[model samples]
Target chain A: MNAVADITQSRITRRFAKLKAEKRPGFVAFVTANDPNPETFREIFHGLPQAGADVIEVGMPFSDPMADGPSIQASSQRSLKFNTSLKDVLAAVRDFRKLDQDTPIVLMGYYNPIYVMGPAKFAEQAAAAGADGVIVVDLPPEEAEELDVHLRANRLHFIFLTAPTSSDERLPAIIARASGFLYYVAVAGITGTKSAEEFAVKDAVARLRRHTSLPIAVGFGIRTPDAARTIAHHCEAAVVGSAIVDVIAQGLNQEGQPAPGLSQKVLGFAKSLADAVHAAQH
Target chain B: MSKVEPRNSFRQGVDENGHFGLFGGRYVAETLMPLILELDKAYEAAKADPKFQAELTDLHKHYAGRPSPLYFAARLTAHHGGAKIYLKREELNHTGSHKINNVLGQIMLALRMGKPRVIAETGAGQHGVATATACARFGLKCIVYMGAKDIERQKPNVFRMRLLGAEVRSVDKGTGTLKDAMNEAMRDWVANVDDTYYCIGTAAGPHPYPTMVRDFQKIIGEETRVQILEAEGRLPDTIVAAVGGGSNAIGIFHPFLDDASVKIYGVEAAGRGMNSTAHAASISGGSPGVLHGNRTYLLQDENGQITDAHSISAGLDYPGIGPEHAWLHQQGRVTYVPITDDEALASFHLCSKLEGILPALECAHALAYVDKIAPTLPKDHIIVLNLSGRGDKDVFTVAEAMGEKL
Candidate 1:
């Protein structure tokens, strides 16, 4: 398996390498882009890196989010009500880039939008807008070859998600093309369904360690600080997506509008995950 | 002679990687990889086993009633004016549609693979009822995911599914149509991988499925080829079938691929008009993209968000078409055209009045296409159209459209 992404120069690779140098797992916060509204989303987005997030993952709100549970799914629906498009998501990334340049923002979602934008153009636009990487939830490694061509040409990292069911036989194909870091989905089910057992996650991380040199970031079902710490113990990064998004959803008012303290509420939750992940290192 | 050479076989088309000339490929989440691989292996083994063939043949003959009558539509032919029209009466089969043909074979595979439960996604509920019927026969627990709107529009079939002891779960997300139901079913299969088998309704989805469902369904074309020969002492000049997920179309077309003289026509649902946004003509109106675990022609916006598909026939109401149909459309071996809602409705009434056979709205799309072209073909030319399903399930929808209460 040849390495498709030479991620050594990318912000994502740099972040992972920096985390390794500090001997601490990075805390990656996940939020829906333009979630609730751009103003509320901006507050959450700008405050994320400062709130102890080492890397930020922004979801490109898709109509059909099969991999996500109800929380993230609801957040996407809320943002879509404002008619948030790929342009808005890219604009959000560009805005975030203004305040923070160090924290890598990976635009994660399904492959359809990028396919619509045409992979090459999407890679160019995503890279131009300061997106560090892209995680297409539905694009398996087999089909990733097409997008890989564009991502490679643009020097944009194309990250692949590995699940518990991604067998040893299938790893070589996936690992060959994956760059920046491997996203280890901690549970077999959709995100935010249930917390993955620590022993199971450790076993998975250990199994994945034999396959690639890329940093592994574990996500899905990491709903608590303890769960974040547990995942941080085994992987290079802890990705708390639906859990942090849940706080934002909770902070919204009854009229489906973002409340005054929405950004603070989300960042405060991110701070807890960051503190736990940082503590797990020592 | 044309410069391009003919392929030896259509069966050998989808490579081991599940690609049919860049159309079909597994684009699913990783969790279903092992299961898909396992199913592929199991299907290969079962396909080679003579005993499995014997069992499937027995079930098709006795239970589902195969060799479903290839009837010469004398009145329809007269009404059409030129082509000698023949109807492949798949509607007369058990469960009143061609859906049972695929369901029987898949349930047999599920049982052989030692799966206790079967999960399926349904649009018009024909597949759900068919699947529910098969599961009852095998005494397996069946769960079906249906769009909430479909559950409302297709109430009788929903009741029929429940009466057959299958649990029908309504998917209320994202247009609440076939695609969302398929997504929910995929999620279910991912969550409960070990104990369940996903019986995809059409020649769609990841490899093994487009091929396997087509294999289960290719019986339609195979039987048609033989039956039409017996009826007219030669092959039909053209084969026409409705294309939704393209099980029936691919099924009836696969056996006739090498028969160069037999022009194949696939009719897709053009709900209002192709020029308008409201239609289910994926191949005619959509561009190639990944959806429902396979890369194919999909009705999606520039951002790749799947748009809603509208059709009076729930069976044809999908944002994407089967990958094989997409490939076939590209290869120019098959011609795909769209028929609008009113045209199909008029054909639905025409078929009932002219032939005394009520056709499902999905099948009526094909009948409507036949109505358009049959009048122009030579009198000696034979046209075989797949009446894929009966209109029993669509009476309510039809009535509603006619401004009448059920």
Candidate 2:
């Protein structure tokens, strides 16, 4: 509707369109910004596009990440240990935009930091930093308008998460407010705790498709390449977060410092998952 | 009474969307949104149902001991030589605290909703014990999440919860305090939404919780109103209560909010001093921020990261206050003050020596404030303080603070 919205929507919409043209599902890689250390995180982030990622979701670290599982929670803690701020997360996006312009970048986290920064300022700064979308985990459609208006004015997609508990009656409200893509949390539980059955996701995605034309992205408990492939078959994209973070965790020393080649290890796993997702039948 | 001018009522808050002047709302994940809405509907229905009220009243009178005595502290009043002080004995409730008042109501709702499992989080294990006791009575599976540090400091309460047949799960994440325990409980509820009901201990969580908890615990103020009138032939001029998550304070404050003649005080735990970073006074020392599902005053850093709170009493060691308290503070309906750990400790010893009642450290914060204010008021002025909990669970922590090993 607005100039900024058009510009931001094109990045994500174009990527999904490109994937659709190739008759393949897109791969989205999620990582907490500045995790393990900013330098290594920068390296991994810059390599995601080359590793076949269609979109990048950067987590803005918060002290209390209630919706996240152990892996993402630990990664957030690691990032916070370095005193990573929201400014640092946007800076990471700016850096990634310098190297890769085509891949859509979404910043995700709880609302406290954004509320602290003021929603209008956060949306403006994020758009200036080249971020395309946002996913505030705790802000459902009911509470999204305060931030959504600012985000829409800035041309950033105010992405909404539709959970397993979102019934037919609830889907309409969520769909009406959602932009960019709908993140269908495959499981009703917190991230990485429970695996989503393929059949259940298929039915949920089908139900969502009947309501809106917006592309659906499945996340939560998508760990291995096979699981990613299976889930990507049912939606426009499959998001892999905690599993990729697990690689970074494994590459850390006992003292919690990043080991040598930690970035490569994380990027390598992301590549494998991406390859599987791209190879899946539409 | 003089001719009263028409005014807005403070009790009709938390509009259908669950807000109290931009302070309270449902700030939970999408997975819990539908369930929270369902809970809101169920609560509204139960509120309208007379049978629900009758059942809760029966349990309060027979099982949990309602209408606790309002006793005049003559010795303490004589010592202060100022206002006559009266203590509302919530410590005499079945679970040795006022936590049972809300827990019984919530546990009954859990049964009505057909939820088989009940989950809760606690700081000093008072709420955990109350939840366990209620679950044991109703034959529901109860799981209590307590911080590892709290489980150690509040070992007696942990034991009490376990003996009551509730599973006490120690949360080792973050600072292992009330906030961490709450985070873990939310995660558990999200993972097991269908069969589980989260019984929030404080009047602070998302929409319905803040309003519902206050409604359930409002019985304290209702009884206090009648008792004070019967004893002194008039309502007290001032009422005081300790505030952590602010349940006790809000419970007693809500009924008297519109009483223009009545004054209210909420005492917060200033661990060392408000000048130092170590304090749990959200109103006095913290800024407005979102935490534990509601927007309220919180102890947080510049980056909006929640900072740890410090208090001698675990029950008062929290980063955020109830949203209603935030709104009331903003509207100047109530006055909030800070009490240092030393001040509370002095009142603890003083109340025990003077009144023969060992007050909970949480309640001692209020007593400490009364010690300061009551001595300054005229002897004719009346002050009623909510003695919210007993000190048995806090004895070990107090002994340790006193540097006397058991």
Candidate 3:
């Protein structure tokens, strides 16, 4: 991955083409803030881009993320216990930005933290820190006009979700305002599973096609190569998150000592996912 | 689809299409993706494993008192002036509420996972007392986080938990209510994730929690189906229950989810009135959003921030409803209605005088709805009401509400 791309060009379009040409689907890895510890993030943030991650979604920890499952809940709790504030997360991203600027980064999570911090200020700090997009999970497209406007004004794409259950009537509005790419939730449930019926993926992608030409990225439950392959055949991109979190959790400090090869483990896993996407070539 | 049992609504949670009508789907964070998948796998295995189901059944029968009585309330029916009334007496369960059913299920899973410590939060003290009771029975170290205000008002339950050898932590931040207590409990669990199991009180958390809790509590409806068959020789015309985080109601309502002939009424605490700012009617006044681990309807502000709620009953003061309840409401199978504080208080005294049952303030909300709807129906109509808990915990609050002190 290049450290710097042409600033004047639409980098998202450029990155999409390069991945498609290489017969490799784009990967967006999502991880909670301050998992294990904040300091450990230095390696995770920098290593992901080098390991072929097209995008990184950093979770902004919230006290009550109702949409999050136990693993993420635990991660958020750990992060919050270490006092991983919005400011702290921003600083980590800014520092990571200095190391590499090509890979687009999106902060994904709940809306309470951003609301408490003030949306305008959050967008400002996020944009200034070199975040390419923001996906507030709880902030639905209908309720996110102001936040979307602020982020767009700062040249940051506002990512939105189009679920299998989302009505055809609501798709156009969601697709019209959405940037970066539309996150088409392949299954009707939480993330982590590698197996969901293939028909569900195809149905959602088919429905989304009738609405917009924007790239449709299937996420939630797409964990392995087979699942990614099935999803990539129907959508433009495939997201793998829980499988990576599990790997990172395994690489955690073992036997009361910090794992020495933490960065190596994450990069190895990312490379495996990238390889999986590439191996699924038509 | 017609079943051998002849059910009413659609069974959409079966993953054929991944929905319960337009309500149930996986809307969650990426970090917990693997854990949820694991939980789904575990649940699937547990469901098919007779050993797992038998163990849960044994615990329920011996510990939580399975098949809690279904009594005919002839006097309450007469007082209502028309419809026949039956009470599913879950209050007689191990911890004096319907919460024990789900706690037992979760505690068994916690043990299976080799988790050593059990943690939970409570507002009315029913779930806390029940969780503590389960931990005591299982010989697990239990820690319960309760809001400071709840602790003060629910001293007897706090003492009961302590007597059961569980540590009770009081949370004093963020309105010092159920939501804050939940936040603190989640934080503690996260801090001790390696050894501790966060036994959530209600079927309102993320993914498997809501699904798992519902399954455990479904025994209510399962038993009620047989009990009603024997009692009235037919299905009741209506089923009424209170909706505090909506666990008990959902437990009783799930087996009947597809039973179209049975009209299910979930009573939410209106605090003062539906229009008042003090109400806890998330279904009546709130919109769908994500909070407390599920994408369900919640009483939130314009900015989508969860709002603090109020009710005379501590358990019914939550601003969010169970996701399944949201699904039921959207599917139009269950009618979500609000009963004001005055109505609940009046029902409490009336039920005490008429039936000699001092109903819990939370249950009183359901009773109030029964009082409202029963009189309007035909005299031969049957309405099964879930008396969720005993009113012993509400003595002090009831006294204050009635302008009488112990």
Candidate 4:
């Protein structure tokens, strides 16, 4: 697993083939950068793929990630406690590039860290670290031009968000410069799964199609395989972040530590979601 | 007072760039950047949508009860000696305060955004109750963050929020008051940026919020303009209201911002005294910094660690003033004055005794200024004061402050 070489464009083909060969839907998993421990970041990137995560989004922790829910916020708080600065998240990405890298790794989270680091430095650091893309949760389409140009120059994809409330007029403007995929927030609310039945994920996905031709990946509140399957039929991919994090959070052992089951739980959940996606595709 | 309906006074001091007279700009953590920009875009469309405005208006009228009355206080004015006094009775509004005016609008916007949950922070708990009411009415899951200290002082409000189906989380951090509550709320907002709609209780927070919340609350002033005319046949010489995060003050002042002849006074709480350490007079003594989301006058240190705020009135015990108030204060369009805890208490008692109206401790600060200025004014001069909230919730706290707790 050459981390740097693995993330190169050529490797993405193989990564895509592996998922196709396994008859599993490609799963993009997002984990807040430096969560639990910044030092163990290499493990998170390497471990996630082994656990059935096809693409990994390492969330660059920010002081205010407005799109996050309590669990992710707590994850960020824990990361910040270890003095996880934007500089550190970028550094971890650079370090991760030293190991295995064929996985499609995108940086996710807020704009403040990027703003603080300056767009050029952030872009340079991200590109140098072999990050494929970046998703700034709060960057509006109107104000993303400067960021979009910088990320593109550095060969990092600038991903944009589309929500249930997003209109046709704003959708193209938001995703015009987007690379990789369009993240359609399946639920109107923040990140984290509630009752799948209560939050209409299918209606949200159906609405997202009118906006962009890019591969629409639905996220937010896709906790169950059924919910994932329900979303997969309407969208190209389904993102499961918070629900997986919740599994890791719940599987913590008596020592106030994430035990062996954390990995198993995530792998099983991802597999189920992939199965749901496969089921829907057929 | 010109027989026109109370309405939004479509004003945007911040241009397309989101500035409020150099006071408000996006000053936030990196994580919130995308979300703020997203919110800004959504708010822009919502602001221009006729359907959005109509829906908000409908909620304001049917749900929150708009156009609160403008009643002439004949007895109270005579007691003041010379000035004719009028009260814009916002206390009579549903949820018992002017806080409902903005929440109804925000909640409606949230619904339009397809947001399923609403989150807010409160000090005196009036805002919390109003937000909870909106959440309940709109069928959204509501969560309110309150300072642990405020929870103790404003117990009834906490209970009311619970009854309204809001999960009240007591933030036991920092000074354990409004500042801490705001910090906790911001943390929550950052975490839940995906699906949660942050119902800012005041005209504070980030760029669009200060401007948007002010626009929503301006209905108070718009209505006051017409109601005063119907009640008095002319615009009052003065408009006065208490300033916590300055929402009500802005609500009453925004309509009259262009009316040069109408003087506006914003009453700030001079807890103990402004000269002393015990005070919540941000404009009177504090400097500008970023907190929660926007850059505004904050009672904070150089490191942006917010300081402790003190006031006899829990509602007025906040560490920041609304951005618009800072602009108004600087532009000299309005005077930001402070009344001591003692003065506010005296005014509270005076209003209860003189007009048979028990004002909220926060509103008492506004009353205190009237008490002082009315005696020296000309007989024909009329002053319109915003009775921001009812005193029922404050009775127990007031009793304790007066050393006569029930």
* Number of colliding residue pairs in each model: 2, 2, 10, 36
**Model 4, C-alpha of A268: deviation from truth (Å):** 9.6
User: In candidate 2, residue B29 scores what lDDT?
Assistant: 95
- Report residue B181 deviation for candidate 4 (angstroms): 9.4
Q: State model 3's lDDT.
A: 0.77
Candidate 1 backbone collisions, by pair: A112-B304, A113-B303
**iRMSD of prediction 3:** 9.2
Worst 10 residues of 2 chain B by lDDT: B3-12
The model with the greater DockQ, 1 or 2, is 2
Tens-digit lDDT track of model 1 for B252-326: 999999888889999999999999999999988999887878889999887777789999899999999888889
By DockQ, the candidates rank as: 2, 1, 3, 4
Q: Candidates 2 and 4: which is better by TM-score? A: 2
The digit string of per-residue lDDT tens for model 3 on A1-282 reads 221232224456666767778756677777776775776767777888777677788888776665444556556666766777888888888998898877778888786567557779899999899787788876655446757777766777788877655676656767777877888766644556335567878876787878887777778776676766666666667787777777666775544233877767767877777666655553
Query: What is the number of residue pairs that collide in model 4?
Result: 36
Residue B358's lDDT within candidate 4 is 85
lDDT of 4: 0.77
A1-282 per-residue lDDT for model 2 (tens digits): 567548545799889888889999999999999988899999999999998889999999999999988899999999999899899899889888888888999999999999998999999999999999999999988888999999888888889999989989999999888888999999989998899899999999999999999889999989999999999999999999999999999999899888998898889999999999999979
- Write the residue-wise lDDT of candidate 2 on B118-198 in tens digits: 999999999999999999999999999999999989989999999999999999999898999999999999999899999
For residue A92, give model 1's deviation from the true position in Å: 1.9
> Judged by DockQ cut-offs, is candidate 2 incorrect, acceptable, medium or high?
high
